[model samples]
Target: MTAILSVNRAQKKFSGLVAVNDVSFDVREGELLGLIGPNGSGKTTMLNLISGALRPSAGEIRLKDERISGHSAHHIARQGVARTFQLVRILPSMTAEENVMAGAVFARNRLWGADAHGLARKLLARVGLDGRADMPVASMTYIDQKRIELARALASDPRVLLLDEWLAGLNPTELQIGIALIDDLRREGRTIIMVEHVMDAIRTLCDRCVVMNTGTKIAEGDVAKVLSEPEVVRAYLGDDDDA
Candidate 1:
């Protein structure tokens, strides 16, 4: 598969602190890549850079050979990139369908009125929201809210989907459903980069893994191989027994 997205030596600084440091990786077309790490590992920062939520202090990000690192978030979204936040972001005042319609309205190829509404309903069902399209998002459960967000992202018809902790709050049953939903997307040949803490999902969904620690890339390869590395173990478990 061709490398659809590339982060080449990307770096981000916040004054004296560095959030992402010289990180580099390639996400191939139709690949589901896992970005895993402990808290404060610069994983989210890297996503922000790719999604254009934050500009990199150095280096570049390219989407299918086009430089996109310095573009605005909206620009990136319009250029076939869409994402779900670590915290589910839905319009509380809007119905599920309306929330999803917003994505279609401002997407890569903008849809409007009936077209957007039609697409929103289809996406809502795709993410298992089914008949709840008219329900207010604020009234939905956490998992349902997440589904809305996922549906919204999909509504954009993104070439690359970025999921930030999409499975973080699920119970065992919900976790299985969440994993299944993502797996379905993978089967559809969607290229995705997911940042998640659940090892089960990582093991089941990712074609490969990238491990980050304290703002730097530490490992990049097979899920089992990367997780077994001493540094990765230490990064998660710490050097001391308490970790």
Candidate 2:
């Protein structure tokens, strides 16, 4: 399968610290790829570079063979990329639908007025937030806020969706709902690259997985095999030295 997105020797630095170092990977079209790592292992930084929130200090990132590393985040979004944050990021003062409408307004071809509102309503309902559309996002529960943010991301009609720990705070029922939603998106052929710590979801949902450690990719392969690798285990659980 052809890759929908490629990170070719990508690197990022902040001051003298290297956040992402020579990380390279390919995300095949219609595949759900999991990026897993211990804390501060550069998974989120890699996502930032791909989403144009940060520029690579070296190398390139491409979406459909077009280099997108240096482009503005909005420019990349218009190129059919959309993402949700690790923390919920909705317009707290706005109604849930209004926040989703903001995303629709910037969608490729861009919807407006009644059309945007209609799409927002549908997206909200898709994420199980139908009746809460008019509620201020700040007044919603944490899981509801996450759903609103997800609805907003979908309002952009993205071909590639980057999810950053989107399932972090969910209860079991909500987790199942989130997993089902992702399964539906995969069936629709959306390419997804997710930074996730939820091992169950990664094991069940990822077509393949990449493990990162100290700014480098330590392992990449089938989920069970990758997770069982000694290096990956050490990265996550520490060696005898830490004991």
Candidate 3:
């Protein structure tokens, strides 16, 4: 498989402290890559950098063979990248259909005209929100809100989707549903890079996992192996000697 995204020596700093330090990895086309670590481990910062929400402090990021440093979020979206946040950022006043249609407007660029509404309807149904299209966002449950969030990201028809903690609040049943959705997404050939805290989802959904600590990569391998490593335990549990 070819690499769809590459982060080489990526770094980020704030208040004279390093949040991400020389982290590098490649996400292959049509594969699910998980970025996992303890809290404040710079996972979401990396996602923001890749999706153009934040600029890297140093090093390079590439989409395919073309370098994509310093591009705006809109520019990055137009380049076929999309992302969902840990928190659902929806317009509380908008109905479910309208929220998804808002996304369709950008993704299809009005090519669909009245058909954009139709496309939004289809996406809602695809994500199991068919009956709730006319409902206001404020009326939906957490899981529904998340599905809508995903629908909005999919509205862009992105080639690469960066998901940050997309499963944090889901119940076991909902997690299973998300796993099915991720599988379907891969079947559709979408390359996914996710920063996930949900270990079950990460173990079941990813092809390979990347582990991080203090903004740097510490391990990359099969889920079980990485989870069992001393480095991973120390990162999550902490070493008293360092304290």
Candidate 4:
């Protein structure tokens, strides 16, 4: 598989602290890559950097060979990169359909009025929010809110998708649904980068994994192998007694 996204020794600094330190990785086209580590291990920071929420302090990030490290979030988004936040972002005052329409309007070429609304309905249905399209987002459950966020991101028709702890608050049934939705996206040839603590989901979904700690990559390769590494087990899973 060809590299669709590449981070060449990327770094992000806040004041004197380095949140991501010389991290490098390649996300291949049409593959699902998992990022896993304990809290504050720089997983979310990496995602944010790739999605253009934060510019790297040093080094370069490329989307299919086009430098995007220093671009603004909206510019990167417009270039076919989209992401979902760990905390779902939604317009509580608007109906689910309207929120999705907001995204659809800017999807490809600024769809307007009826065209945007029509696409919004289709996207809502795609994410299983069909009948609930007219319902206010404030009235939706946490999982449904997540679905709306996903639909909004999908409306953009992104080339690279970034998910930050998207499965954190899901219940069993919802978890299954979410897993299936991810599977469907993979089948559709979407390139996805997911930051998750759900080991089961990671094992089942990711073609490969990258493990980080203290803002640096610790281990990477096949999911099971990386998870089984002694250092990974110690740093991420803790001692046997603790587990």
State which candidate has the highest TM-score: 1
Order of candidates by lDDT, top first?
Answer: 1, 2, 4, 3
What's model 3's TM-score?
0.93
Q: Considering every candidate listed, which one attains the maximal lDDT?
A: 1
Q: How far is each candidate from the true structure, as Cα RMSD in Å?
A: 1.0, 1.1, 1.8, 1.7
lDDT of 2 at 108: 75
* lDDT at 4, model 4: 95
TM-score of each: 0.98, 0.96, 0.93, 0.95
lDDT of 2 by residue, 12-93 (tens): 9999999899999999999999999999999999989988999899999999979999999999999989999998888988
Residue 144: error of model 4 in Å?
Answer: 0.6
In terms of TM-score, how similar is model 1 to the real structure?
0.98
Candidates ranked, most accurate by TM-score first:
1, 2, 4, 3
Give the Cα error of residue 67 in candidate 1, in Å.
0.3
Clashing pairs in 2: none
Per-residue alpha-carbon lDDT of candidate 1 for residues 1-243, written as tens digits (9 for 90 to 100): 799999999999999999999999999999999999999999999999999999999999999979999999999999999999999999999999999999999999999999999999999999998899999999999999999999999989999999999999899999999999999999999999999999999999999999999999999999999999999999999888772
Error of 3 at 66 (Å): 2.2
Q: How far out, in Å, is residue 162 in model 3?
A: 0.8
